[model samples]
Target chain A: MIIDQNKIDETIKIIKANGGHGIQKCVQCGACSAICPGVKAGFPLLCRALIKDLLNGLLEENIENSSSWGCQACNRCTEVCPQGVRPQEVVFAFRRYQANELAFSTSAVTSQMNLYETGHAVFTDPKEARRKVGLPEETPTSAFNEAAQQEIRTLMDNSPMGELGLF
Target chain B: MEQIGLYLGCNIPLKNPDIEQSFRKIFPALDVQPVDLEGAGCCPAWGTAPSFDLNTWCAISSRNITIAEEKNVDIMTGCNSCFGVLSEAKHFLETPATRTAVNNSLAKINREYKGTSDIYHVAHVLHKKIGLTKIRENLKYKLDGLKIAVQTGCHTLWPSDVYKVKEDNPYFPTMLKELCEVTGATVCHYSRLEGCCGMGGMRSTDAEKSLKLFKEKLLSIKEETNADMIVTTCSSCFMQFDMSQPILKGRGVIDFEPIPTFYYTQLLALAMGFDPQQVACISQIDRNPIIAEIQSDTRRIKEGM
Candidate 1:
């Protein structure tokens, strides 16, 4: 594979912009992978591997891999990294690239759609539960307030999520 | 006695209104006022906006914080995922570049990312703001003989840097255990105490894989602690254990009987003399056996005293 230095630089730039500070300082220490439940659960992608690929300008070749989504984003990787590489942030950075520049998972799209439509990512008719618990039949949430839902919709419409046709 | 704005996020209101009700009863009893975070939307969750872009994630999360800012109070959430997203959003907005981009998006809605309010998990508020002394004093009934396992959830412990209140040792956090102990329950030390319950976006992405993680944690809790009840600080973890365990068992993934689960606030509400029907109304798994055990133990303790 052709090693595109410009692609690697662009990827790093986006990662840095998205709170993946100290990512380049990653020392290929497998601590993140060792601690990651995703790796434990048999996912192929590991934080150390992803960082190596990103640094080597190989992210695009592996951009479509589902293993990127395996991250729980538990921040365990961030906690154990000696170099402060914050591998979870790098995972998120790659996810952002996949989601915006390429494609997003159906579940992600549905969740964004839920947020746009109802002002919540997971909306259920909560009135009965609230009333059962002696709370007002209508809890103070966007689900009960049309004006609030509109405000959320407007925000999503103007955000990058909307631009990506996520909603 | 400061009023703290309550951010319900999505799950607590929908899947576990009982936890919300528990907070309602317990917060006032502790002298900490719980204000309704009116018109606040989703934390937009990590699986959604943060997966797409940071600027969008921060903008949406900042909007929610701005609502709390307008109320002039710090925001507290019962869900760890909401805590994680909102706290990270606050941290993101602290940087000029990210804040400017987020503000640029917010400008469309006539809003700005003002770093005025801090986000807190409810457990932090109980430990820091409410104080263990107050909690102990208000306990009308002690969980004297109850052996409880605690799940602090992944979000509450990790990324401790952005969080305003953190466990003294984030790796082996004591805040949840300490809070559980104040209810007079013996907090058990489990091998997998810090493992993820796998109830986040991962569950939706791959249910089988998610259940594998939950099964491992649950089995470890059962084997290591063998506690009567499991208490958690996060609503998602509550669902994973209380809601998912039976299904996993039925699917033949595990053979152990499902353990009863409680959000720490619900346990507090019950220990503070509220009826179980009042605070813990909606549990997927049967809690009657555990509740009966607690009541019987309380009576025995009362007789001894």
Candidate 2:
């Protein structure tokens, strides 16, 4: 599944506009790669390499099966990034672009997509959910009751962020 | 006190009710109210859409926001995963570009998020509006003898701009420990206070890797702090600690209780003299030591008299 080089370009523009800097300032010091908690633990993380690939249009071939998905999004790279290019966000943005272009995204990504389709993420079968997750026979009324009485909810509704929807 | 609709996703209400009871007991004193927002389901977090289809996620998350708006109060969450998803959704609808796309998509459901209300975790409520002084004033039982390791769950700290606080370091356990200190507990300083639990998304995909990463941190706490309990502000982290610690022990990772993972609010309630059963729901755990410790404390206080 070759991602259009143009799609990668568009996501970079989106990420930069979203306040991510140093996307283009990469010196490829391997700082992001070396300091990455995932990379050090025998996980596949070409974080610095991936950013360079995207910038140089070298990601089209292996875009789908790339190891970028291994990123935990912990932003260790963002913290260590000498050039300020957030490899974490860049990789995510790239994945998002390529995922959109493909017919089938990764299983994890698709499962989450199914969540909105059914209002539940894990179980597609309703009866299975009840049997396995121990969902009650009722409509989970008590759970909502407890939620309604929590103090933080009231404070949240009343905050400025709550008002602006950035909460 | 004004009551806002509360959205207790999954873990807090069923798996961990101690925190729920604590919020019930304490918030009234803080002049804040909790409202019941019905028909609300999971915000889904990483479970929502890795595909990044903005419209579906917005509609589902906005549907949740709309429930709170309908109740005419803001939605509050105890789970960091819930807070992250709801907060991010709110951010999406507020931005002009994302808002337009989401609004155009959600037109099918007749639901639109006005970006009207805020979503908050309980820690923010205690530290901000409810102030430590007020909580300290109400404490009848001091946490003097208990050594607590405050675990600030990942979502509670990340994307720092959204969940702002007075911490010198976002990874620092200051806000949480300060709350514990107000109740007279000693907050042990530990390495990796800001480290990931590695359980959030990985639990569903790679349980072994997730448990392995989590076990390392759990063992570190026992070696570093020798603390009685591990306290946290997120439900996922709580579940990971409470369940993973014991399971990892069987796997030869550690040989301890994994320190009881109490919600910060529950610990506050315990310090305020709330009974363990009232403040801590027993059904949530497979261990008895947490309740046993509180009962023993009650006996000691009785004997002193």
Candidate 3:
């Protein structure tokens, strides 16, 4: 990819706008990528690649990439990066950009919708499972309590996430 | 008794309540009380609130953290993702502007992010706050013959800057290994000891590829250690190690018999002589035989003496 200073500056602006404050600090040392599970698992545009792409002005263009969703949010990249780029934050920022455009990897949809409805990204009907182990059918969580679920839904609707009209 | 507001995230109390049961059983045995952080919701998790932006993520996580903050007890979660999301939320939410922003959102629900409470993963609580010497003293059963391959999990180690407790070195973690040793189970070393189990978002994205990644890690655990079972500190790792074994074998991903897996709390609960069914009944791999082996061996030793 040819260096487009225009594109680079634009990418940096958009990412910083979405909270990738350290996007420009990336030196492309590949240290973050070296230990990234998504990178090792064959997600092409994760740590180093995502940072490299964003720095090369590939923000909107890479919006559809599932690699951002592939991140475990383990923050291993942040720990290893010498530049303090916090590659995980950059990945999350790109995810935010994608989330804003509503161009999410299909796998992410259920969890987002679940979070909206249930307050938990990963939820299951707990009654049967909990009872089998002699636990209360209702876990003291938002999933069971109607008021708490409403509280969570209202909170999500009241934030920038609600601005996306995901609900 | 020291009290921790038990923040029950999605996986532990819902999908695998057995781990929650085990944790509850073990904490009291150590003279610590598990306080329920009732009406606690999600950490809002990464794929959900966090995928949008940090402000929204922190706002949502602050709901949970501030619940404990009000109670004046620190938060402890069995799920590493909860620990990761909540800790990172607490750390970043300390900024005045961010704190003010999220506090405004929180004011709707009458909860405030006071930044008074801290977050602890099960591993951190086990190794750092509650020492291993306490662990060894409380054990009624010894895992004399069992060998364990320990999965310390990624979130428990990295971004150590945000964590209240940390491994001396994240790369070569000894805390989980030492926690196992207190049960008298020999902790084995594997090449992929610190690698991801591919259980979290990666698995949610691509199941086959995620299993493939775990297969590589499982192979390392199987061959490098040839251990009796897999032990881990995170519930996600427990789900991956325990539930994936039979599926992997069925899919021809691995050629060996299934290795049972446990969260260290369950192992400690059993070592303290809790009923296996109450503490660890739910599993893909049968845990009954392992339970019998540990219990029977203990009973026989006591009888002999």
Candidate 4:
């Protein structure tokens, strides 16, 4: 709860650097949280609360909070915000910081690995399902195309995420 | 051959290909070819690439969209996450800086996103692109006497600024309801019609909590509207509704028998007289009763003819 000026400035700077350009536009209105499904689902640090903490210099202090992972990326927070803060962007920005810190929620690591392996984070074997549905056993997607997936892997491998070695 | 690139994200083609199969049948029946964008990957789903870096998210999604851009057609998907994430990537990539960075990653793959291809969800394509009148005219069966509840889901509704297809009013959306009604089904209004289904990020993070959130929404659809079935436009919402009920019931979370669910295309394909097993019969929850009801309507129409 201690408001360190240096920490607060660093917090604002990090989030803005991570694509939360509208961080300072927030007027502290609770409209974003009022409509945030993540908060209602009991993951406390999202939208208003997460923004409040980030604005108050609690970024590193709340690194391990899994609430950011609960964001549906529905952009409902962006829709209802009066200040045009786009609170969802702020949440994602903090999530970028968290991911960089290697504080990934257990589920995130699995999905990231899936992306690296199959080019789809939420992949499943579609052979049986596609067959059952009377379609070709393999979908015409990157999941089955090794060359395309290799291209995807190269793209991810060259990105900032590759630098983290999470893949 | 009027066509659009069919962007099948992770779930539809892999987990629930029935929705993919239905889309294939429905769009072509309406005279719009669902062209396959081969080699397209995930929307890079929110939790994966998007969580790591903004440009990484845009780049991975851009790779998928660039496939459509190369085909010189916009993209359409049933997955709301695909719709939302792809649109967000397009919007972000419009900026000079973000576009430069994302295109850098894409350049390594020999693809450059010129931001030409717009992202379209199946809901938008059906209502706005195909037109309700066109849909109604082509239907071979009408779903009379079937009371339905529609879940529009989150991604297709929100942050409207990024989407090219604008709803008349995103908050109280009427497009999905109208699309359903054209097939002669009454889309009953429920209290939580616009509420989140608690899928996507929440589902991956905490399965049980996500189920509870979905249960709350399902209970609203049941207690308030007493709908005969649930229909949604988003693949993720369709999956959550299709997969969650048995879990909710098995855990004794709800005492009512679960309602069968469909992605809009699956139901639309049935209304157009496609075979049930091919288009609508692959849900975790049993949909035989609803499919039978729809098939009987088909028989009556055929007999009257």
Which candidate has the highest lDDT of all?
Answer: 4
Flag the better candidate by DockQ, 1 or 3.
Answer: 3
Docking class of 2: incorrect
The residue-by-residue lDDT of candidate 2 on B1-305, one tens digit each, is: 87766787655554454566677777886778877666566675553343344444555677678777866787778888878677766765767877776565445446566777788778878887689888877765555677888787766665554553435666565778787777666788878677667666556545666766776677678788988777888877887887777787677667665577788877776666666666665433453575466445542333232
lDDT of 1 by residue, B1-305 (tens): 78999999999987688899999999999999999988788898888888877877888899898888888999999999999999888887888888888888788777776788888889989999889999988877778778999999988788889889888777688999999998778988978877888887677767888888888889888888888999999888898888788898788877878899999998888888777886887888899887766656434334334
Q: How do the candidates rank by DockQ, highest first?
A: 4, 3, 1, 2
By lDDT: ranked, best first: 4, 3, 1, 2
Q: Report the candidate with higher DockQ, 3 versus 4.
A: 4
Best model per DockQ: 4
Pull out the clashing pairs in model 4.
Answer: none
**For residues B1-305, what per-residue lDDT tens digits would candidate 4 score against the true structure?**
68999999888888888888988888888889988998998888888888888998888888898889888999998888889999888888889999988877777888898988888889888998889999988878888889999988888889999999877788899989999999888889888888899888899888877987898899999999899999888888887887788888888889999899988898888888888888876778889987888878443455434
Local accuracy of candidate 3 as per-residue lDDT tens digits, B1-305: 89999998999998889899998888888878989987788897778888887888888899988879889999998988888889888888878989998999988888788888988887777777778999877777888868999998888788999999888999899988999998888898889988999998888888877887898899999989999878888888889888788998988878998998888888888888888888888898988888888777543324232
Q: Supply every candidate's count of residue pairs whose N, Cα or C atoms clash at under 3 angstroms.
A: 0, 8, 0, 0
Q: Lowest summed-lDDT stretch of 10 residues in model 4 chain B?
A: B296-305
lDDT at position A66, candidate 3: 81
The residue ranges of model 4 lying beyond 4 angstroms of the native Cα positions read: B297-299, B302-305
Tell me the spans in candidate 3 whose CA falls farther than 4 Å from its real position: B298-305
| lDDT of candidate 3 over A1-167, digit per residue (tens) | 67889988988998888778898888899999999988898999998888878888877787778888788998889999999988888888898889888888666677878888887888889899888888889998888778888878878888877887667
Model 4 has fnat of 0.88
**Preferred candidate (DockQ higher): 1 or 2:** 1
